[model samples]
Target chain A: MRIIVPIKQVPETTNVKMDPVTGTMVREGVEAIINPLDLYAIEAAAQLKEKFGSKIVTISMGPAKAEEALREAIAMGCDEAILLTDKAFAGADTWATSYTLAQAIRRIGEFDLILCGERATDGDTGQVGPGIAAWLDLPFATYVSKIESIQDGEIIVERMVENGYEMLSMPMPCLLTVVKEINYPRLPSLKGKIAAKQKQVAYWGTAEIGAQPNNIGLKGSPTRVVKIATPQVARFGKIVQPKDEHELNRALDELIDMLKQKAIL
Target chain B: MEYKGVWILGEQDEGRIKLVTLELLKRGRALADKRNVPLTAILLGEKIDAESLKKLGHYGADQVIVVEHPVLRYYLPEPYLNVCKVLIEKHHPEIMIASATTTGRSLMPALAVKCATGLTADCTELDIEEETGNLIQTRPAIGGNILATIKTPVHRPQMATVRPHSNKPLEPDPQRQAQIIYEKVDENLLGSRVKRIGFKANPAETASIQEADVVVAGGKGFKKAENFKMVHQLANLLNGAVGASRDAVDLGWAPYAAQVGLSGKTVSPKFYLAIGISGSVQHLAGIKTAEMIAAINNDPEAQIFQVTDFGIVADLFEVAPLLIEKLRNHLPDKEA
Candidate 1:
């Protein structure tokens, strides 16, 4: 089996600052790291390679710095990597973004599976994975937590739904967006690190991937942001901590009193 | 079709309407009424009852567009998207709101891409701009670190997936009337690339967390997976549903259904007990509607304490057992 894992580079900051006027992320000098969820995708692919003698390939679409994420995936056990970077790829919505990835996958030739994180933390849209599946015309599943079984021509997996988990069986040449619960990622090996440094990532752009000019990036994206601003937190509760054992008991008594006054207990 | 009315995606489970669908309708009603446009509800399923259609009318839908077919019995992303594409193209609704449940979370994005429109996911707040008549979608970004308000100026139908429990459902009024419009699904277009193997539901209504009036949640402070048993024991004692933070869910301490966060479930219980959750902003966003919040954690600086009405600084391993014992004593009739 052969697999393609899509990874994304996001800002390391949890409180990512946004441009107050434009409503876009202020990405001038923020340090970037692989999206936390994509690690699970890489780990899932690596485990398959170890168990089934499959080859692992990772693809990332971003600025030049995104190659760092691809190399990190390689270090974690992928066989090859592709970096889809170009100025035209900037400001791409999930539609144009997934379309670009679909074109890249077509360029990469045949693969049994394409893996992606359930969503990206930065954009936080789970759209691209399914969008890619739509464009490539493949069976796809999202928020998958476990691969119950996998073999020639088919795979059965557990996907998280609204109420409970659903066991799904689908044929190969399918795309899966894995959840973080799928597996714990392994640290890069010494040999893997050296190999990752030496491996060259195939860089593909709009022209190389045969992506249509009209459906490439900002030009292709239909959604335009009108504004962005910080939201107001509505709660006005008192936040406090007890000082000692005496205060602890007093606090508990006060809580019980409040609950009683409100007739909650 | 002038892209006028507000449309609510009516999501259902086993022929019953989901709460998120009702919540979306209420929000849709306000937006539609503000813009002085009729509100529409789109329903796709094999069978939909007249009572269900009436329910939509009572909830403020002026029209209900339904596409019933055998292939639409269960949700298949491809087929669902196709149905949405047909309705969206034909009606050209000015705004479409969907519940951020599993089905809508998947369906809306796919449909939005196909329609070349903008979709805001897991929105905590939604409104219409008075001047431009654009949709104002606000949601937490960066794993719920901060909330961001986004607007779509260039799109025809502004779409958003509202978090469940973020809005209250309007009281039903039998006097309200809505025209039920039936549509036929093209069987060929309804064919899905993904084949269903089977759908096995654990069947616990509270498992979704939306139905739980009281939720006992745990997080990374539990330290290990086995410690989650304490959290469940506490919930069981209180007769409340068990929930978890994303960390606990990802670490295998709790099932994904029990997760409470932006990417997970949004819950607003009457009483929420955070056993060990340190509280990420994403986790806090899910519980903002809880009438009262009580948190127990070892770290003093944990953000969970900020929103909690009652804060106890101690290890969950210790506090959980004590609370369970005290609660058990207080309510001897409490079910375990």
Candidate 2:
């Protein structure tokens, strides 16, 4: 029942603002926290570890600062942590990112399951998890809401679709991208926090993971951001203030007329 | 190895083409015309009827490629990935587009990784670069605070997924003719370790907010869960769908399926009504494509007011009941 959870450290994207003149993200003072969704992955792993009495290892690939997110995973009950940090890993897209993670997972050897958050907050693309599964050639499921059972050599789960929920069964040694509906993550325990403080996280670079020089960085990423722009926020801003009941009815009539003109009602 | 033609991975349900696929065909037709290449629709399913295949041509496809297999009857990543990889290799396409639905989101990324190509997710805009003939993909980033335009400089069949409802399908023309091709592959390519066991439909969901023409959303200012009834009432009156802000969903006042925001679901209904929502950027991200938006809140300077077409600075409690009563009385029963 050994499990692997991939986590990410992301800026509070809600707090990320755009400079009006430069049109670049103003990230100077924004605080970085664990991707809110990844906590669910860590929690799913922790719940399985408690039930099966097995180990849970958390992994992350980013700048050295990402180790703080790994340590937080330990505080939330992951047994160990690994940080894949290097200057070479910069500017990797989902493809290159997943390739490096697959190499790390190969180095970590065998595991029963790999769990990841549905998507990272910054990129908002739920591709890396499936990308990793493709690289590793493992069966995978996305937008999983519940894990119904884990029997001999197989696991059953429910995944979301357009209209309904589809129940699926996949062999062990598979991957899953979990949604927020999975479970409410538990807070870090005092004992777990003490252990996390003492746990020495292992940091690996491209060389240690035997990653191909061309496949671990900007050169390996097929997609490039050619331009970035702040979206213009424009509104009609028609306002109506009704001080009394009669005026309120008048306003309502006007609103209905607009709806009728738009053919929305 | 020259890449040519524009390919759209058409989605099918029970052997019928989905609306999203038709919408992609509309965009694909334009890009192909611009590039002077043929627009091809790739359909994979079991027992697809002839009429369904002909509809692809009517929409815009110059060629419709069909790969029928029982395993593909339902979407599992392994088999679909295998089939797509083989087809992509056999006939190199310059560009490929898919709808950012459950199937497309699941399959395209895995296929892109296998092919070692670039893929942009949930792109709102796509165009051909005049200089390099590259696909210019634009998508929102960091909760719609910014947009990033991406390109695949060295990859063949540059891939992207557009969210459903972001675009409309073109008018069908039955006079159009399309050449159809059927492909056969090895049985081993269809094997999969994952299996679908069952499907559970949500009967209580009368209308999906994603496909609804009108949406009535409520936020945290509603105070109590019971207050959501008014939101539902308004939606019911309009025969629309009810939506909830992230705050409302987090407070257990509404289901996550009804939640609209960066983390929830993106909706592009024709008309949207926001009540008590202060319009965080994340929530606004989901509804930015909505044709018209109207907001009601007690606060005069709420951020929602900045993006809405109509703004009412008043208490929602009084407004909701009054609006409901007025509509019920003034309109015919069926219309209301």
Residue A51 accuracy (lDDT) in model 1? 90
| Candidate 1 collision pairs | none
TM-score of 2: 0.96
DockQ of each: 0.42, 0.68
i-RMS, each model, one decimal: 4.0, 2.1
Candidate 2 on A72-187: residue-level lDDT in tens? Answer: 99999999899999999999999999999999999999999999999988899889999999999999999998999999989999997767788999998999999888899999
Q: How does residue B70 of candidate 2 score in lDDT?
A: 93
Docking class of 1: acceptable
Candidate 1: stretches off by over 4 Å: A13-30, A232-236, A240-265, B203-206, B220-230, B246-252, B262-266, B285-291, B314-322, B329-332
State the TM-score, rounded to 2 decimals, of chain A in model 2: 0.94
RMSD of candidates 1 onward, in order: 3.7, 2.0
